[model samples]
Structure formats: structure tokens, C-alpha cells
Target chain A: MASTIRVRATSNGDITEVQALIQHPMDSGFVKDSKGELIPAHFIQELKFEYNGKDVFVADWGPAVSKDPYVKFSFKGAKKGDDLKISWVDNKGASDTTTAKIS
Target chain B: MTTITGPLATRRLILQGAASVALIGLGNLPFAAQPARAAANDKYPEEAFKQKSEADAIKALYGKTAEPSDKVKLDAPEIAENGGVVPIAVTTTLDKVTSISFFVAENPNALAASYKIPDGTVPSVSNRLKMAKTTNVVAIVEADGKLYSATKEVKVTVGGCGG
Candidate 1:
């Protein structure tokens, strides 16, 4: 299946700045559908970024986060061409994984 | 002009004393018991996120209240035209920052998002959040086992929570 995650990790020898954009409905459950029925909450609960088997950053998000969330963070100790792993799990247990090379 | 240094240093000391006194006036004692918590990195803070009140959410997440601090820099729009995607950012000069969290005062649930910053990660994060209406957006930084916060009011034109 196609990944719903797109990430860019750029390294400046000392720090690796990561920016990710994820596609999700992020339904807060309070919103009503076209039929006037409430849409159940189905937002990403946790998203993690790993580098060299270590967790660099982890985000625990609630439904208040906007749809198609975009987050930016930076970390040290990763060099160019290194693989950075990213993954997330939504409230409904749906998830996606993607890897990006630091450049 | 070099003789002005003597008086400047004395003035700085007086200002520092006044700042502490102001803190006391607000009923916050400096360096109170810090509720050190284990790193529940893999576990989602379900209870905290479900809290409707900001105080309850912070209590549920960190087991403590935060004191307002100038060191925690919160960058947010004064007026968010679209409450659905209000850009929020937080940065701190504090050392040993472990986590940072956002709270929307008027959202259905106050706790919006929390980010864990490992040792190598920078103590800064930027993300978009949903706001139900005009409200105060708070950014809390947990540094060196103590919690400090910064807040700003953001006017929302359109509510994000569906009616």
C-alpha cells in the first residue's frame, strides 16, 4: 500500500532537521458529516521518529491537531545519507511507515 | 562611564529580587516538588488528552501545575483566520527539556499535542492545531523535571470543531 507519510530530513553535520507531512482525516469526532451525523474521532495518536535505533522525537497528538498534520523538529547526531525512520498510529489503530534519507 | 557598572550591578540585583517577589505574589513558590515521571514514550496519554480543562489535563499528564515563565517562548498568531490550521510553535532556552505540550483553552479537549524531546533533539517544535473558538493557546515546557509555561490569546474567526 502507498504510504500516507512524506518526510524530509536534512543534516547540517551537527543537526538534522526533519519535516513531515502526514495525510489523515484527523476527525475530532465533534464534526458532523454531510448527513448531519457526528464523525467518530480517528486522529493519529502517536508519531515517532527514529535514528540509529534511538528515538529522536515522538509526538502524542489529540484530535485537536489539524488534518494533514505537518510537524518540524531537529536533532543532532545524524549525518547525510543516514536513514531516518518515521511511523504513526491513529486512534483506530491504522498506521503507516516511511523512511527518508538525511541529505 | 565605566563607573556606571557599580550602580548597574546593584540595580540588576534589586530587579531580580523584585521578580521573585512578584512570583510569590502569584502564589507560586520557586522550585517546588517536581513530579518526576517515567518516560511513557510508547504509550499515548489517553487520559490527559480526554481532559476538558487545561488544569486537569496538565495534572493528568504531569501530575503537577506549571508556573508562567518568560524563558519559554511561544510563537502563535494573534488572530487565526482558520481555526482548523493555526500554526503554533514553542522553543525554550531551558536545559534538559524532556517534553513540550500544547493546550487550547477553549477546545473540546484542552490537550492538543505533546512532543517528547530526547537528549539529542532540539527543544523546539512547530505544528498546526485546531481551535474551537477564540481562546488562549498555552505551551508548556518540561525542563529539568520542572514545568514552565507560556500562553497567548489567539482570536479565531471560524470555529474548528464542527457544529
Candidate 2:
């Protein structure tokens, strides 16, 4: 499966807000394919974000979630051009990470 | 601005897309990209809730043998320019509604969203939903072991990105 994840960080010399959008089918693995065959279940099991060695957000999701997951969250005490790291792992053991600088 | 053309553009989309899927961090098994099914006593337990028609959507949320009642109210815009984020509200005049759910019949997955209504929180909720096209929005309320419903149609002029 292919998707896209975009992360944008904005800082005003005091607060840093981050927004992320991930494209995914979020299939719960309970449906049948075109031939009416049962498709295997799969979904994101966990997600975590860290900034400057501090935990920002952690989420445990199941199949009930939606497709192209989108998240918006903010934190205080950061400046423009700072690095923010985000990562996610699905039930299938797949993982990826990306970084963005506050602008 | 940079221009990406022909096969390379398609390749870029796929590669970028693959990176996103990897970020999702799915499980050990192969990634399955199908929608979740509905729960038992509902419809397709593993697939997203769907309805062939407006009536079917109502039945899935309420129950196959459930009957329609006026206690449930659906509030939607008379017209919307963008189907991506149309504001909708569901309120029930009934005494106690255990839960409330909204459904879009024409969407790839009929079950748009659902909410668990706790006691004394007021039997109403408001949120935005993406409509593939002009379609019926059905509100299903579970009250005192019974399911009641109401629906409203919003005219959408412009569909979301995918249409």
C-alpha cells in the first residue's frame, strides 16, 4: 500500500504547532476482495512523536480508525528552524519517520 | 517551481506514497488497504458500514427490524459549496439515547462516524463530514433499547479533492 505523510511545523518564537496528514486505507482487515474472498486485517497499532528528546504525543489505534489519518497538535517553548521528529508503526511491523523544521 | 513529467512524475507519487505507508508502521503481515467492516448484528463486521439506499443505512445503524421515529432530528445545511467539510448535527428529543451515529449512503464506506452518548451529556452532537456527492445523511439514535432515526439531504455544489 502507498500513501503520503506531510508534517508542517510553525513557530512564533514561543509556541510550536505541528500538523500531520498520512494517507492510508486503514483497512481493518475484515472485508473480502473483489472475488468475495476475505481480506486479511491490518492497521496502525501505535504512534509516537518526540521533540528535543521529550515525548509529545503517543497514540494506540485499532481498525476502527479512518483513512488518510490527519493530526494537529501544538507545544510551547520552541523557535523557528527547530527540528521535530515523528514516527509510526503499523500492525504489520512497518515503520517510517520524517522530520520538519519550524518555519 | 519544479516540473515533474511523464513516468517520473508517477514514480515520484508512488515512492512518496510508499514512504507514507511505511511511516504508518503497520504490523508484521502484509498491508491490507480495505476499509474496516461493520460489527456483528450490524452488517459486514470487518468492513465499513454501507447501505445500498437511504433506508438500508438507517436500518444498519438502528437495526434491521427497527422503525423510524420523529424523536431523532438531523440538522444539515440547505446547501454547501464544499462536500469535504459539511457541518451536521444530530439531536434526539427522546428521554435517553445511549449512542448516536451518522451515516453517508453514497460514500465508499457508508458508516461515516459514530459517537457514544454518555448519560446526562445532552442528546446532541455536531461535526463536519465529507460527502462524496449530494447524498442523504442519516442520524440513528439508540434509546432505551430501541433505535430511531431521521435524515436530511444537503446539496453539495463542489465535491472534495477526490470527488
Candidate 3:
């Protein structure tokens, strides 16, 4: 599926940090049916973040995770205008990549 | 000797067998259809969570006199194209944030989600939420031995409940 990501940066001028948000269903198969059948859990197993070709963040996720997962974190040394790239892959083998620049 | 008896008994047996088959099939219909119904009924608890006003959800999660604070930063889209999954993130620069949570003001239940912040981990969390319609999304953060909050309006374009 096509994915979109947005990045926003708010700094105290001392620390020019950035926050990124991604959109995807991190479904975990634990949900059950009314007949008591299990909804197979599907979720994002891994995520990788890079800033100008340098690895910045990594996270491992599971079914307990909510759908359309969003991720946010801080990174130092970024200016008012820099590139932040993000990509994620789910257990279902679906993946998306996008980028945001500091503004 | 009398001719072979009429086929009345044989015909009766055949008819009885057919009737039994029909009855069995009818009896199993409900049973066969139950699993699907059960699955559909198995919506996330948040679906039943009553849609409350933003103020109400805050009170429910914190207490009668919950107050918003600056320590909590809640981020979400201004307009969500689909209500099925809306991305949400909660972060706090608070010195000691113990936990974070997401609550849907308009959902059937009050508390939509909760998270425990582990020691050594940053006081932040992100996840997708299932929204039934347009509603206010509230974020609660337990930090520095107190609770703080922030909120944003999320517009759901498509209903997530098979609507």
C-alpha cells in the first residue's frame, strides 16, 4: 500500500530536534472473532530511520501495537532545513518509505 | 405364493432418510454461520467505549479535576482521510514520565488505550487508533509524580467499523 509520512521540528534553538510520524496498521493477530476465532496478528516487525544516510532510530514492534502506527523521536545537530528519511516494513511483507525536511 | 409385498415399506424408508438429511442440514446452518458473526462481533474494546466529550474522557482517565499541562505534547493529523487508522504520538519532556495513554472522546468507551513507560526508555509512544468518526484525541502523560495532557482534533474520512 502507498504510505505517507510527515516530519515536524520544534526547537528551543538550543536543540533543533525533529519528530516523524508514519501511517500504517500494525495489526496484531490476537483479536478474536465472536465465534472465538483468532484474527491472525499482523504488525510492523521492524522500522529503520536514517538522517542524511546515517542510521538514527530503530524499533521492534508487535501485535499489542495499535493500528496505523505513529513513531516520534528526537535527534540532535539537525538545522532548520535538513532531510529526515524513514522507512518501515510490516509482517505482512508490505513496506513504505518517505522523507521530510526540517522547516 | 403372494406376490412380493408392495414397495410401500421401502419407499417409506427412502422418504425417512431424505427427511433426516434435510433436518440435519437445517440444524447445522446456525452453527456454521456463528463463527463469522462472532468474528464480526469481536471489535476492539474501544469500539464499545462510549464517545465522551474531550473533557469527560480526561476526567475519566485522570480524575474529577484533571487539568492540562505543558509537559505533554500530543501530535496527530489535523484531518484524517480514513477513520480506520489514525496515527497518534505522545511525548513528554517531563523529567519522570511514568506512563502515557490515548483516549477517544467520541468512542463508545472512555479509555481507548494505555501504555507503561519502561525505565531507561524515552517517555514517548506512537500508534494508530480506530476512530468511528470525527472526534477529539486526548493524550495523558503521568510525569514527575503528576498527570498532564494535550489534545488534537482528528477528522476521520472513512468509518472504520465497516461503515
DockQ top scorer: 1
- lDDT minimum window of 10 residues, candidate 1 chain A: A1-10
Reproduced native contacts, each prediction: 0.97, 0.00, 0.16
Residue B119's lDDT in candidate 3: 45
Chain B of candidate 3 versus the native chain B: what TM-score? 0.62
Docking class of 1: medium
lDDT of 1 by residue, B26-113 (tens): 6732222222232344578877887788887887789888999999999999999999999999999999999999999989899999
Best by lDDT: 1
TM-scores of all candidate predictions against the true structure = 0.85, 0.46, 0.45
lDDT of 3 by residue, B8-67 (tens): 767778999999999999996554332221101212223112224545444433443345
Model 2 DockQ, alpha carbons vs. true complex:
0.03
* 2 against 3, candidate with superior TM-score: 2
Q: Total backbone clashes of model 1?
A: 0
> Tens-digit lDDT track for model 2 on B13-120?
999999888877665222232323232232222222433444454454444434678878788898978776677777778976666666776665566555544443
TM-score of chain A of each: 0.98, 0.86, 0.79
